[model samples]
Target: MPELYSMQFLLFLAAVLICYYAAEKLFPRFQWVILLCASLFFYTWAGLPYVVFLLAVSAACYRASHIFAEPGVSAENKKRVMVGVLLLHFLILGLFKYTGLFRRWSGWVIPLGLSYYTFQSVSYLLDTYNGKQEAAGSFWKYLLFLSWFPQLLQGPINRFGAMAPQFFRSRKFDSRLFRKGLMRYGYGVLKKYAVANMLAATVSHIFTQVDGDISGCVVVFGILVYSFQQYTDFSGGIDMVMGVSELFGIEMSENFRQPYFAVSLADFWRRWHISLGAWMKDYVFYPLALSKPMRKWTQHLRRKFGMQWSRSLPAGAANIAVFFLVGLWHGADLHFLVWGLFNGLVIAVSDCMAPLYRKVNLPKKGAGIRLFRTLRTFIIVNIGWYFDAITDVRDSFICLRNTFTRFRASAFAGDILIYQIPYRRENYMIAAVALLIVFVVSLLQERGVDVREGLLKKPAVLRLCLYLFCALLVLMAFPFAAEAGGFMYANF
Candidate 1:
């Protein structure tokens, strides 16, 4: 797949934008058709054979939802249709996601974006069946929703209700929106190429080092870099994707919300991958929490414990189940499973502790308190990255063990650490500066400041200089393998 930030893909996107706007102006009623065509073309480029699969899934969903939408459809029939649709989605997901987990299917490659699109399909089907949304009136509009090029591969996985109308409606060009989108796009490119990719050179080298060869400090340093690398790459990809969506006058949901600033594991999840978390809460957690067995469990807990403890029980269990699925969604591997459960358990504990937190009346507003909480959450999140970064389950634990036992502050001093890595001192300096920029922006965002809008208000020369700097970073890193490999989440 062509990297979204690459020159080739940008050229393709430019052509699509020009044609899309032309279609809107010249053939107003059929602008949706242009988007549909563009989306399919983009998907075909990404995975040609899978375009048929996408169409099949979209067609099935379109037909099923429409059938369910017909007046006088029995509730039982609607439920069955919903179940069958969900089963089909899970079946495809299982085939691709778990194919390599077993020895019999080691040769299979998971289709690109199967997890993302499948979830999207499931959400749309559920919405239609439950009457929360009407089925798309046209197959083309629905197809465009499923395969929209900007977010087709890695998504802020959209909903039919949120996006379909935008495709059907005509939108005039807005220069201000266009500039904001471009600025956001540039910021994403800067994060991906300049920061994330730069760190990748050192991170990959450190991660692959033999356990015996690296000290605790080295392991800790590697874990920290891995955290930043992940944030930049995954969130950066969303930034670019959302920016593209914005250019088309379609607002995609925000996926990240200064996740690093979260005060607790649950808050961290709320801020990170915000869309996926919302999906799971809406579809998985709510349903599971309200299930008969879970309700009974909650009542039993209420009898044993107090109301506060009992109320969170069902949701806590649902959270665990959701995280397990979240882990499996990432990959069919033991490490991911453990990673998922670890997050679920942490969040559940937090849920159970909510009452105590209120009783203690911890300071909620002071900077000192906020800083402590943020750092605590950051450390907890870094610990979880060990499971995510290490593909081999056993090796991940060993590395974790070594981090505490063999740590040496001297690892940061000289040739033993920084000098031995592939990245030079200058690269590290650049990364530091980039991270500083990210931190400042995140801090501003956390305080409800609009950094982009603020930048736009500055003098024209200042804005031009900043844009040029971002562009330079992107141009310098574009062709470098270490700086611009395919996005990390794109693997899913």
Candidate 2:
């Protein structure tokens, strides 16, 4: 079963497509049933052991929300009930996802999709309490939302308001939507299995090589490659999930939007892992901003630090805290924590300098300025990527050192594959071509244009030729060895 993961995914997806269409055509009212059943089966495929826990969590939230909806429940009573529900959900999440880290003696096994579903359940509860969305009248509908197969692994984290109506609506299967969805899914597959996986393999070799034996130059190169590998792997997974959901006539929120082209760290956050950042802002940042402490702090700063300082200071501090939490959310490791804080600091410092940066004399609407800023931002992001790629802080520093220092001719005299890993002409060629393609696509996207749409609008012969070329490139570049590996973000 472990050896056949890819085969299993293909089979599951085929079964889902057939069932979805059949249900839509035959018994429109049973659409939610089909989704729920498909989702359960997807979870069960991971193993039967965790199915009980999944259902239990769903039931807990289902019942708790009903308590909130009861006609005579006092406002205080309702708040208490909702708090209890949130706590129970978090307790289960901690027990399953963080028991090992929290309790050293315990050897608990965390269940699959616990993090993803927990967030979904909590979001639904919060939405219901806030009256932004209604509680699912039926347990099955709620369960389906929690366990939707396409988003079960990693997510765009659909809100109740976003997903519930779609789940209940009857979808008339359309060929164009299916074709576009399939193309998107195929593009993601190529990005992951072909581009990111190949890069991952190379990065793994570099990281495993003896530390000091490799020149700092090689280490720097590895860090840069790892940045691309991580982004492609994560965003590629999101593309696949969104594409799969689109086949069912549901549009998942896009998780990425040409983040590398962002002019500022704040803009990058808006573009990358968009759902997560939005979630933090909606649930965490807003609440913090409106709190008594923050309000008071803002007022104090206004009087003492001047109006400009008051407006920026509170938000800057909050941004730092959010980034710190974001870092800690990735892993228990310090490196991830530092990576999160590093981004937070970037945004905070950028916010402080916004006024001065705007005043700098520069070209406003020229290709030269755009190119320079793009390059500058890319370099800053790559440097930040060191914290994420290297497990050890010292190793990251060493890579930075090697990147800056010029090496002698003797450094290139060794077994190039071990020291200078990307020594092969083919390796350089592939990296260069992959980067060129990504840059072109990003440029198109940044200009508010769709690459696919633009290409399709061309003359028939040109469009066909372009598609055929992409198909051939993907086929030729596919990393067969990594076929069994699921996307990197799937674990998250």
Candidate 3:
């Protein structure tokens, strides 16, 4: 596969862009065919076998979607069909993604973006069955939506309803839109190569050490740096994806929103990975919360414990269930499950404590309280990162215990500060500066300033200089960046 940042990827993108625009000019109504062709070719880069597997998935879902539109089919039968189709595909996902449980042979490959496209396929099935949208009339077009290159890896999981209109409409290229996309893509590349890659080495080094090899202070520092590294890696990739889609006159859902500024666990989730949260809420949480068993549970709690239990407890249970799935979505690993449950329990506890919070607050709307909540939430989120960053379920707890129980500056300096990497000091400086730029940009966005639009208003000479300076910084930083295999979420 062509790496997103590689020279080959640039060449491939250039070819696609040239053809895409030419198609719009000559064959306006069918311009999307160019994109469809590009998508298939891009997926083919992963391997011919993967393409065959993808075809099977797309064909199955495309065929199943028609069952929803079948004349005189009972709703129950449609529901059964949806369940059967979903289970078979999810079972495939499990067999590949969680091979240890199923005893797959050594050296089998998981198809690229299997989990992401699967979710999109399931959403298409559900939406069609519910009469939320008409079934896709063509198999190839539906395949294009699943295989769209920008979202083929980690995705915001675009909905068919949201994507179909933007994709099918004829769109003449706009220079301004293209420039904005180019700028955002540059920003994303800079973030990945300069900031996230720089920190990734030290973060991995610290976590992979035996508990005795590192001090609690170093563990805390590693996890703290990891928080920044993860955000930049993930949101940067999404930025790149959104920017690429924008180049084709397409708009995707915003996946991140200055998640660090969030004031609560629920708020953090709302701001972070917004697409996945929305998906789970729409497809899983709402369904389970509104299900008959949950309704009965709520009524029983209402009789026993008042309205608080009736409302909060049922919703809390659904949240837990949703997050349990969310954890599994990342991987079928124990640590991921723990990470998800940790988040769910915190939210559930907060929900149950809502009345007490309402009564005890001194000044809920105060800036000081707001800042405190944001910091508190940040701390809470970092605690969960232990499970996420560590591979072993037991090691996560060991690291957490060390963090609180064994912290010391002297030991950290001796054990971790002396850690070796190529250009470690220089990489640290570059990462710091790069992170500051990202923070400022995020701050401006938070303040409702469209940074790209603001840049467009500047003289061409000034904007060109800024872009050149960014390029220079990334070139300098990336050469020395260590252990940056690729975007972090691609591991999923």
Task: Report, for every candidate in turn, its global Cα lDDT versus the true structure.
Answer: 0.81, 0.74, 0.86
Worst 10 residues of 1 by lDDT: 100-109
Q: Please write out the lDDT profile of model 1 over residues 239-309, one tens digit for every residue.
A: 89888888877888789999999999999999999989999998999999999998898889899997977
Candidate 3 residues 1-492, lDDT tens each? 777888999898989999988888899989999999999888888776778767888888888889888988888998888888888788888888877745456455777888788888888888887888789969988998899989976787889988989888888879999999998889988888888888898777777764554577887888889999999889888888888999998888788999998989999999999988999999999999999998899989999999998989899989999999999888878999999999999999999999998899468787899899999999999999999998887888888888777877776657675555345588888889888999999989988999999999999999989888888879988678767547888735
Clash totals in order: 0, 1, 0
Pairing residues by index, what is the TM-score of model 3?
A: 0.96
Candidate 2 lDDT, tens digit per residue, 1-492? 221127767787788889989888899888778878888887887777878877988898888788778888898988987898889887877665555764355443556667778777888788778777777879988888888888877887878788888888888889878867876776676566556766776677676663644576566667777878888788877777778888888887678999888776687789888988988888777878768999999999999988778878888888878888777667667888888888888887887787887799777778888778767787778878878888777776666676667443356445346644433445445545665676787778888987666655678898677567656655655533333456565554
lDDT of 2 at 404: 69
Q: Judged by lDDT, which candidate is best?
A: 3
Q: Candidate 2 regions off by >4 Å?
A: 1-5, 101-109, 210-214, 405-416, 419-435, 454-468, 478-484
Clash number for candidate 1 = 0
TM-scores of the models, in the order given? 0.94, 0.90, 0.96
Off by over 4 Å in 1: 101-108, 210-213, 413-420, 478-484
Instruction: Please identify which of the two predictions, 1 or 2, would achieve the higher TM-score against the true structure.
Output: 1
| lDDT for predicted candidate 1 compared with the true structure | 0.81
Whose TM-score is greatest here?
3
For candidate 2, list the clashing residue pairs, or say none: 216-402
